[model samples]
Target: MKKLLIILIACVLGSNIGFGQSKTKLKEVIVRPGGQKVVLGTKREKADYGHGGAPNNPKYQTAYFIPAKGASGLIDRVGIYIFQKHSFLEFLKPSNPVYLYLYKADAKDLPGELLVPEPLVIKPKKNTHWYWVDISEYSIALPNDGLFAAVSWPKATKEDNGPYVGMTNECDSCPFYLYHFPSEPRWLKVDERMKKSVEKGNKEKLNQNLMVRLEVSLKK
Candidate 1:
C-alpha cells in the first residue's frame, strides 16, 4: 500500500510538471471602442461587389498594405466587410474557414515572408456590416516598411457553398492590392485597373479593392 501511494503521487507530480511546461503565455491586450479606432487601410462606407465563388478559385486571396504612418502601431483588430445573400439553410451550414496571414513585401512589392507563421483562422460570422476579429492577444507589430494582410479561403466543396466577402470601389488610388494564385502568384493594382476599365468601358478586366482593414493603437 505504501509503495502504490508513492507511485501514484509521483505520476501526479510528473503530469502537473508536463502540463506546466506545455502551457503558453498569452500577451497583454486591451480592446478600445470604435471612437478610439485608428484605421490602417482605405475606409469605405460600403462595398459594391463580392469575390471568390467556386472551389480552388484563384480570387480566394486579397491583401492590403500598411502605410508608413500607421506602421508603428500595434495591431489589435481586423475587420472585413462581408455579404451573405444565400438562403437561411445555406447560411447556417458550416463552410471552409478563412485564414488571415501577415506577410512582408519583397523587392518587387509582392508578398514575401509570412510574418505570422501560424496564420490566424477567422470564424465566419453572418453580418450586414463589417465582421471584426480581435487579434490583440497575438501582439502583432506593424513592420516599418509595410506588412500585407492576406486572407485565403478554403476550397469550396460541392456540398458547401462558401460565403463571399464584400469588395469596395471607393478608393481610386488605394494602397490595397488583390492577389491571385492561378499559376505563379501575382499582385494586381485592382483599384487603378478598375478605374481605367470603367473609363474605357472594359468590363472584362474590371476588379475592385477587398474591404479589409486593420485597427491599431500607436505605442506611447
Candidate 2:
C-alpha cells in the first residue's frame, strides 16, 4: 500500500511539472516577435514620431520624410529618421514607438516655394510608442501661421535610454515601417499663443527648414 501511494504522488508531481513547462512554452510563443498587433489611436489623437540609425545600412546614411497636407509656403517639409539605433529600443518590442524631434529653419534656410503632399494616417496602441508627423497644429480654420513641420513620439519619455523599433504580428518576421499624418482638431494660432507655446521650454519657433531628431528605448 505504501508503494502504491508513492507511485501516485510521483505521477502527480510529474503532471504538474509537465503542465508548468507547457505553460512556459505557450508564453514564449506569445512573446515571440510579432505575437500581437499594435493599433493606433483615433483620428482625434496626435501621432508620435522618432529618428535613429540602423546598422544594416552602410554609409551610415539614412533619410525619411513625411509630407504635409496643406503646408504650401508655411511648412515646406517635415522630416525624421534614425541616425543610429542609439539604444536597445531599436529592437526587441511588440510594436515600434514614435520618436519626435524639432528643427527651426532660419530665414537664410528658406529655399523656394513649398509643395503640399498627402500625409499618411496611422493608429496608436496602448503602452506602445508610434511615430507621428504634422504639417500644421490646426489646418481646418487657421492654416497660415499654424504651418510648421513637427515629428513626435508618443508614450516613450525622455527617461528611456534607447530607441526601440516596434514589431507587430501582422507582418511578423518582416521589417517594420511607420505611417505619417497631420495633427487633429486643426490647431489655430490666435494672437501668437501658438508661437509662444513653441518658444516655451526646448520647443522653438517655426523655421524655413526645420529638422528634429528623436530616439526611443523600450522599458523592460
Candidate 3:
C-alpha cells in the first residue's frame, strides 16, 4: 500500500516524493459551525488514479459532483483529502495556490451556475489527510439534485504542480468533471475526456472522482 501510494501521487501531482503511510480512518473534522457537519466523498482510502492539468491548458480545473446526501439548507465548509508530493527542503518553498469554487449541479449532473461570487484562495500543505476550509461565510445552499466542489489551477501551471487532490475507488463510482480554460462550455465529464483520449489513439483514460467535498448545516 505504501509503495503504491508513493507512485500514485507522484504521477498525478507531477512530483517525485513519497505520499506517506495511509491511516485507517478519516476522523470527523470539526468546524466553527454549531450544527452537525457532514464529510462527504469516497469514504475510503484514496484510489490509485488522479487528475490535474492538461496539455495547452495552463489554467485547468477539476471538480467532483457531491450529492447533498441529506445535508442542511446552507453549506458551511469544504474539505479535500490531499497528499503532499514534496517534503524535503524543497518543501520549504510555498505551494502553488489554487481556487475553490462551488456550483449547483446541472441537469446533466455537471456544474451549473457559479455559487461563490469570488473564488477563494487555497494554500494547500505538504501532508497526507483531509484539509478542511471554512466556507460558513459563503452560506452556499444545497441544490435539490446536488452540487459540484471544484479546484482550479493558475495560468502559470503549464501541466501541473504538487499538492494534488485525491480520488477513491470505494463507492464503485462518483461523478467528476474537468474544465479546459476559456472553453465555451467550460466543464467536461471525466468519461468524456477519456473518450477523447481514445479517439486520439492515446492509451490514457481519466476515471477519477476527486476528493473535494463541502459541509452543510443540519439545522434549518
Candidate 4:
C-alpha cells in the first residue's frame, strides 16, 4: 500500500509540473523565427507615472508614437511595463483591467482614428515587469511612419491597488498623445504641455516616456 501511495504522489507532482510547463510554452509561442521581431518603444524603466501609472480620468488613454521598424510590417504584439506600490498591503489588493488600443498616425503626426474594432482589455497576471498581448490575428497594417500603441489604464480600485505603467527617464524625441475629455473628448498631442513649460522659463524638460513597446514583423 505504501508503494502504491508513493506512485500516486509522483503522478500528481508530474501533472502539476506539466501544467505549468504547458502554460509557459503557450505564452512563449511568439518567440519563433518566422516574424522579424523588432521591439519598438522605450525599453528603459526609471519610475512609475501618475500614482504608479494608474489609469485615471484626465488621461483616459496614453498613446505612444512608435516609429515603424521597416518600410512595411505587421505588428505581432504590444507590451507595457507595469509595477505596484511598495507598501506591505499591496499584496492584498487586486489591480484593475487595462485596455490596449491601436491608432493611425495622422498627417500632423498625431494619433488618428481607432485601428482595432474595439480596445483589448488586458488583465495583467504579474507585477513590476513588462506585460504583452498577442494581436497578430488582427493583422493591423504597420506603416513605415509607425503606429500609436495606446494603453488605456483604468483607475485603481483602491489607493494601493494598481496595474501601473512605468515611465522611461528620457522621451525627448518620443511623441505621445493624451485623451482630453468632459469638455471635449479627443486625442491631443502632449506637445502643448511642453510648450507651456518652456514659456514659463522652466529649463528642465519632462524627458519622460511611457514604457510601451511593440514586436513587429517586417514585410517588403
Candidate 5:
C-alpha cells in the first residue's frame, strides 16, 4: 500500500508540472483614461516609413508609443499625456489613431501599428492642445519584444496644427526628437517659472485643457 501511494503522488506531481509548462501564455492589458495601453513584445521597431515636416505650433506635442511587451511589439494603447512644463493635457478626442513609433526602453526598434483597433474620440481643450482618448473596446495579446505602443494619425496634412513627430524618453541619455528634424522640441527648454512647477510635482501639475489620441485596447 505504501509503494502504491508513493507512485500515485509522483504521477500527480509530474502531471501538474507538464500542465503548467504546456499552458499557453496569457496576455493582459491595462487602460488609462487617456486610452494608453501598456502590454508586455518580440521585435519593437519596424521598417522606417514616413514623410513630412514637424508641426509648427508649440502646443502640438508628439508622443512615441512605448510597448510594454517583447518580438511582435504590438501596442494596445497610446498614453496621450507627456510631462510638459508643469501641466498635463489629456486628449480631447481620446479615440483617434495617429502614426507613432515603438522602441524598447533602451531604444531598440519594434513593430508599428501592425494589428490594432481604432481610437474612440478627438476633442481639444484650452491652455494646451492635446486630445484625450478613451479605449475601452479594443485589446491585443502581448508580444515578445516586450510590451510597447505605436503612433497613428490620418494621412499627412499640410496644416500647421497636427503633429509630424513622436518623442520617446526610452533612451534616457539623449533628448527626444521629432520625426521631421533632429532638433528637440522647444518645450524641453521650459522657462524658469515652469521649471519650478516641475520640481513641485503633480500637485502643481494642472490640466489647462485636453488634446486627443486613439484607443485600441479593452479591459473588464
Candidate 6:
C-alpha cells in the first residue's frame, strides 16, 4: 500500500508538469524600427486656432478612426502639437495635465465604448516641441473597426486659463472626426457641425482635425 501511495504522488506531480508545458504562449510583439507610425486626420501648416477649456465646457475633442485594413497592433505612444497663444500662455504651462482616452466607435462613428477603465493622464514635458504621451505600458490593442483616440483638458483654475491644442484649417485626407459642444447633446461630425454653425452664423463653434499621431507595433 505504501508503495502504491508513492507511485500515485509521482503520477500527479508529473501530470501537473505536463499541463504547465502544454499551456499556450502569447505571441510577442516588438516595436518596429522608426516605430510603426500612422498619422491620421489633418493639421494646418499654420494653426490659426486652439481647442480646450474647462471639463464642463464645450471643449474640442479629437478622434481618429483606425482603418479596417492593418488595424491590428499594439499602441505604444501618441502625441499632439500644442500651439502657443499669448492669451493661453498661463494655462499651457508644464504643470497643467492633459487626459487621453481610447474609445470604441459606435455605429454612427461617435465615441462609444471606453477602452481603458481609467483615463490616462499626461503632463507636458518642459519645452518639448510636441506634447508626447507615452502609454506603451498599458499595451492598448487597436480593434480592427472600432478604435479611436481623444484628448481633453480639465477645468481651468484661478491660476491657469487652460491650454488648447493647436489645429490647422487644412482637412485633406483627414479621418472621420467629431467634436462636442457645450449646447449640443451629442458628438457631431466636423463637416456637419461646421455647416450648421455657419448657417446660424456661429463661426466660433467651428474646429478642425488636431495634429495628432500614433506609434504602434504591428502584430507579428
lDDT, candidates in the order shown: 0.56, 0.25, 0.59, 0.56, 0.29, 0.52
If both were scored by lDDT, which would come out higher, candidate 5 or candidate 6? 6
Q: State every prediction's TM-score relative to the real structure.
A: 0.68, 0.22, 0.72, 0.70, 0.31, 0.62
Per-residue accuracy of model 2 over 95-156 as CA lDDT, tens digit each: 33433322222253211122233322222332323333554432322133222333233433
Candidate 5 structure quality by residue, lDDT tens digits, 71-185: 2322334434321211243343332224433333333442334434433223223322233333333444444433334333343234322332222212322222222212322
RMSD to the hidden true structure, all candidates: 19.3, 25.1, 7.3, 17.4, 22.5, 22.2
Residue-wise lDDT of candidate 3 within 49-141, one digit each (tens)?
443344344456777777766655777777776655555865677777767788887777788888988777777765667677887786777
**Which candidate number maximizes lDDT?**
3
Candidate 2, residue 39: CA error in Å? 31
Residue 36, candidate 2: how far off, in angstroms? Answer: 42
| Model 4 clashes, total count | 0
RMSD of model 1 against the true structure: 19.3
**Which number leads on TM-score?**
3
User: Candidate 6 at 101: error in angstroms?
Assistant: 1.2
In model 2, what is the error at residue 151, expressed in angstroms? Answer: 2.3
Q: Compared to the true structure, candidate 4 yields what TM-score?
A: 0.70
User: Model 3: how far is 40 from its true place, Å?
Assistant: 2.3
- Per candidate, the number of residue pairs that clash is 0, 46, 0, 0, 77, 1
lDDT of 3 at 184: 44
The residue ranges of model 6 lying beyond 4 angstroms of the native Cα positions read: 1-46, 54-71, 85-94, 125-128, 157-159, 172-185, 193-205
For residue 162, give model 6's deviation from the true position in Å.
Answer: 2.5
Residue pairs clashing, model 3:
none
Give lDDT for model 1. 0.56
TM-score, cand. 5 vs. native: 0.31
TM match of model 1 to true structure: 0.68
